[model samples]
Target: MIRTLYIDEMNTLHVCDSPYDIEVTPKWLWVDMSEPTKEENLLLSQFFHFHPLSIEDATTVKQRPKYKEYDDYLFFVFHAIDLRTMKPEEIDIFINSTLIVTYHKEASEEVDKVWHTMLNKKPNEKVTTNEVMYKTLDAIVDNYFPFVYDLEDKVFSFEDRHSVDISTENLIDETFDLREDLLLIRRTVLPMRDLVYRLLEGKVLALSKKQKIFLHHINDHLIKQVEMIESSREMTADIRDNYISLNSFRMNNIMKILTIYSVIFMPLTLIAGIYGMNFDVMPELHWKYGYLAVWIVMIAITVGMIGYFRIKKWF
Candidate 1:
């Protein structure tokens, strides 16, 4: 999908036609492309001087989050958090002086919301391309915080409910999944954090002082976000380790119980096996009172073993 927005006199208008031309001078142009066709790729290359490698990277799905500074434009590849599934989606951005282009593998609701907000501005309002970009980037980054907090809440809930009788497998798997999400977020956010730092340092010739300050603000937010993500990753790892230890302890306990039961039954099994053997010298077997005497002896032995086990607290 491709959507274009051309801003004139601060009133935003959507341009629908492919290869659309605007007669009025556009202070800024925003192009959003998701799974772009060959034609669209060619159009971007021709109009924006986008590097072939950058275009290739944009089309390739699930590339690691990174940034590439071209001679004419800056390319940013990052992940946008999907709130519904708590997964990360790839978002690529290419920015030049007059135009800003975004490439994505799938639709992003957060990106859409930022686009709408920018489009609704009234005429005569002064909006820079940088400001729009800032808002768009910030919106994407901001959405992750709530998702991170939600993950923390989930961990707390699990701890509260299952602290005593927790399923080790389930707890460990959940923690690992959370760790994976945080790792993904870290890969996506850290590079962009560095990119924002560069922008603030005035490395981009297209940025103004005001724009740099705005980028710094965005960068600060990203820094805090990165810290939070790192912390979450560590926390999940700790939780996973704790669950593993708990599982080991539980297994040892079950083994001990089984061992005690086997020990208590060993003598009884031996006695039964010895008396079952038939022999000519077995005088007790021939006596009528022998059966009652053996029964009394076996009962006494069983009761004695039970008392011993209880005193030892083996159960």
Candidate 2:
């Protein structure tokens, strides 16, 4: 579907299903194409004459977040995340002095919102393609916050559980899943942050001071998001390490106890082995008091070993 929003010379807002339906020269024009068909996609070449590479990138479903500056316009491959699944929704943008075109394979809530706001403008309010573009970008960035904060809260909760509940089931799996989610969010946010940085540093947009400020504010949000992602990633790593370390410590304690038992039993086993041997050299086997003497010897050995172990604190 293709929706067009344009402002006439009288600064009145108008909406049309097709850009060709608008007769007057618009002060600013916005063309939003949502899942356009092949014929509708031709508007890129027949109407706007965008570069083939930019058109291809725009039509494609998944492109990394980036912006390319052409001779007359700038093309951007932006992503809005699916908050429920943490997947990216690609939204391509083409912007020049008087026109802004948004092409997306899927319907965009952010785009719809900006479109609505443009349509419902105050009588005296002025709108431009740049302002519309900024609003869309801002809306996309704002959408990220809820997902980020939710992930952060989960990470915090998982960390707390890990601290107090050592036997919690699937702890490692949960940690890894959280890390994976953070990684996905980071993939979208990092490139977006770079794209915004490039927009701010370069003169491609010809933005007003206020617009630049607005973009800067978006950049700040992106920075905070990146920081949050990194911090969460670190927390997950710490959790994994702590879990492994705790298991190792428990294993060492178990091995220590087993070793102490083996040490105490070694002499008793040796004494029993000698008596079990039937040979001519076993003279004590026939003595009347031999069994008693053997019992006393074994008991003495056991008591002596226990005393030595206690002195050294081996147990």
Q: TM-score of each candidate?
A: 0.74, 0.92
Cα error of candidate 1 at position 296, Å:
4.8
The lowest-lDDT stretch of 10 consecutive residues in candidate 1 is: 10-19
Compared with the true structure, what per-residue lDDT tens digits does model 1 show for residues 1-315? 788887665566656544366677777788888667777777677876688989888876567666778887878777787777766788888887677888787788767887888777776576665666678778887887787677667666665756575467777777787777777667667877876676666556467667667777788888888877777777777777777887888899899888877776787788778789987798888898998897788788878877888898866
Question: Could you give the C-alpha RMSD of every candidate to the true structure, in order shown?
Answer: 4.2, 2.0
Query: Compared to the true structure, candidate 1 yields what TM-score?
Result: 0.74
Question: Candidate 2, residues 1-315: lDDT per residue as tens digits?
Answer: 999988888988888999999999998899999989999999999999999889888875468988888888989888898756779999999999899999988888999999888888987587777888889999999999998898889888985576677573489888888899999999999999999999999877788889989999999999999999898899889988888788888889899889888888899999999899879877898899999998999899889988998899977
Best by TM-score: 2
Alpha-carbon shift of residue 235 in model 2 (angstroms): 2.0
Please give the distance, in angstroms, between residue 77's alpha carbon in candidate 1 and its true position after superposition.
1.7
Tell me the spans in candidate 1 whose CA falls farther than 4 Å from its real position. Answer: 1-20, 24-28, 120-126, 163-213, 226-251, 283-311
